[model samples]
Target: MAYYLGIDGGGTKTYALLTDEYGNVLGKGKSGNGNHQINVDIAANSIREATLSALSEAGLQLEDIRHAYLGLAGADREVDYMILHPIIRNIGFTNYTINCDTMIGLRAGTNHPYGISIICGTGTNSAGRNTQGEDYQCGGFSYMYGDFGGGGSLNIEVFRSVIRAWDGREQPTLLTDLLLQLLGYDAVEVMFNDFQDYGKQVPVDAVRLLFEAAAKEDVVAIEILNHQGVELGKSAVAVVNRLGMANDAFDVVLVGSLLTRGDRGWIRGPIEQALLTVAPHASVVTLTTEPVVGALWSAMEEDGLTISEEVHVRMRSFSDFELIK
Candidate 1:
């Protein structure tokens, strides 16, 4: 009768799932902006709301859960754990495991101890775990930390390209019109004025237009996607080299919006080419499981459950709930 909880807390939203000991997804809850670096109170409240909603849907109380796992963004350092642990502890789960979101994204796709994981959402990062349980990471510290190729970064690049095109510094691009259309501006001049007057950050989701433009063979947009893919590949290769896993036949899970969204070939194709150049034996795969599912799987593992391939397949197939979309 035991149950488990899994949470994926991110910069834009939070997702929580409730599952039975047998891996059946019983309930799911979602909330907003749970990255602790932004605002701990907002993050904590989001986590609490998602947890309670999932618990209520599962017809279970907090005390009924045996264990929980939280995969969180902006939780890289020990200080981050120190700040986040208490937030969850206060949410009524005493037995919990917390780790960076990239780890769970990796675990969601494979059980291999040695593999690379590249996440490209609001931010980008890469991590690889060796057979000895040693971990190596690259590019999760933000742009200031020398990371690029996430949705946020790509969006920034798109705006810059549009600006350059408008000013005739760069070749004319469809992105100029596309960006204005999406932003509800009729002309580039207005966007230019606003961008200069007030530093308004573009929505990360607006990167979808880049995908749309690329689908139509927009040179600038496709170039941006390709560049991002190469950067992501470089990040993965760095982790693989750091862990000496280039020769290992390991999984490289691609997670996050830029990789998972529509017609991802513009991104995926280049990334695969770049990784294979360095790690010929590496098998690149898209992450199909939501991060919360990875957290739940880890919870079951921590609880001493022997998860078979059949169970893993079943868990992957259980896509009944929304994933904070």
Candidate 2:
């Protein structure tokens, strides 16, 4: 009756899951903002809280778990490890492993043990594992580090395009109208004043307007989507080439809100086109399962259990578990 635990700590939220050896989910827990880059104490407390909630729900103590896996955002650089390693150790798990959140996102999208994962949510990043178990990552640091294509980037482009159209620097686009409509303003000038002079921040949900304009065949919006997709695809290609997986048949897993929740073809189509240029045999998989399950699977594997079909079936039955509120 071995029990396993999985925790996924991200910039916005932390999710935890507890399961038996057979993959029947026993309990789930969630909490806020677990990225140590923002606040180490908050991240540590979030992870601890989620873990305890799940354990309590399952009526088990931390020592009763055979293994635990934590897939956490901001766990990339050695500096990040210096901060996170002690936090994880202090959680009282005798057997556990920690990895970047992207790895679990990769696992959630495919059954394969090794492949590429590209995440395009509020921000963008890519990571991959080769058959030899070597790992390579690209573009998770931020825009200054050459990472691009996500909701934030999309909104920036939207504003830029609207400004260009207003200044007669580019052809008029429906993005202007979409933006004005979304912000409850009748004119771009008023919205601009609010943003530039009144210190109003761009709403994250405004990225959806780009998709809406593109759906209506707005050239500027479509071009924005294509540019973002191509950039993200280039990141994936870089990971593939680094891992020497260009000729291999593997899954290129797509994760995050932009990739999973938005209009698929506008962005994903260009990404596929760009990726196919290099890795022709690669298949794109949108992660339908919560990444916490992948962390659980990783823990199960670490405990010397194979991820059999029955286990997968049982896990899939709970695939719709919402990690985000």
Candidate 3:
């Protein structure tokens, strides 16, 4: 008779899921930009809308959820959690577990309950749970300090390479024509001016193009992807080492496009190689589960239960756009 609600709050989007005691999702909702990168008002509204939408779809009231979990980045900052807790608590749900998105991401792929998770999206970070479920994390120092091989990093590197090429400082890259074409900046001078502008950030979607150029054997792009993968691998190794999971046959889950589906095969290969150099026995897992399931599982386990293979199999076979019943 219990209901569980789970939320994965990200910088660009928020996904929420509702399910019955049996782990059959009854409803799901989505919203936008629920991170510190966004304004507090906007983040609150997103959660409100997504929560209500899911509840409405399930024909259930907010009070129906016996427990809830919010898996989000940026909660490491006390102020960030401070900003979110009130809004979530006000929604008529009392028992809730809030944690970093990495926690749920790792749990999503393994019942080991303790593994390293590396997330590479607009940004990059790694987190893990020690044997006691005590958490350890690394590499989210922000774009300026680290976020090595993610969307933002990809964009920045490509843009820098293009400008260098335009100025005759760097060798020609296949990315030259593609970047210009994607931006409609047929002229280098125009591209220069556009880069100086602050509109929509100049480095968006650079990784996808990098993938395309690499597909055509563009040396620069391929090198970049390879470097990105290596960087990601190095970062993952640091986290595993910090948690002492490096030599443990520890489960490593790669999340986000760069780690899982990125076309930079050369890059991902190096990353794995680097990790093995640090921990040869480690096993890496590619999660096919959306992290929301981990959030729900986390909530349910508060009562000493586990997410068995029966539930995992069921969740994997479940379809899209339907309320979890």
Tally clashing residue pairs in candidate 2: 0
* Residues 1-325, model 1: lDDT tens digits: 8899888898877988888888887878999988989999999999999898899888888888898889888879889989988888887779888888888888788865347788887778888887666787787887887877677778888888998998888888888888898899988889989978998888887788788888889899889888888888888878877888777788999888778767458878877898887889888898876777887887887787766787688888655556444
Quantify all predictions' global Cα lDDT against the true fold. 0.83, 0.87, 0.77
Q: Which ranges in model 1 have alpha carbons more than 4 Å from their true place?
A: 59-63, 111-114, 184-186, 198-201, 323-325
What lDDT score is found at residue 284 in candidate 2?
89
lDDT of 3 by residue, 62-99 (tens): 77778788887677767777877887777665788888
Task: List candidate 2 segments past 4 Å from native.
Answer: 319-325
Q: For model 2, what is the alpha-carbon lDDT of residue 236?
A: 89
* Whole-structure CA lDDT of model 1: 0.83
* Cand. 2 Cα-lDDT: 0.87
Model 2 C-alpha lDDT per residue in residues 1-325, reported as the tens digit of each score: 9999999999988999999999888878899888999999999999999999899889999999999999999999888888888898898877998889999999777777789999999999999998888899898988999988688777878888898899889899998888888789988788777789888877778788888888889999988888888898899889988999989999999999888886658878887988898999999888888899889998998888888888887786565446434
Higher-TM-score candidate of 2 and 3: 2
**TM-score of candidate 2 against the unseen true structure:** 0.95
Ranking by TM-score: 2, 3, 1
Query: Highest TM-score, which number?
Result: 2
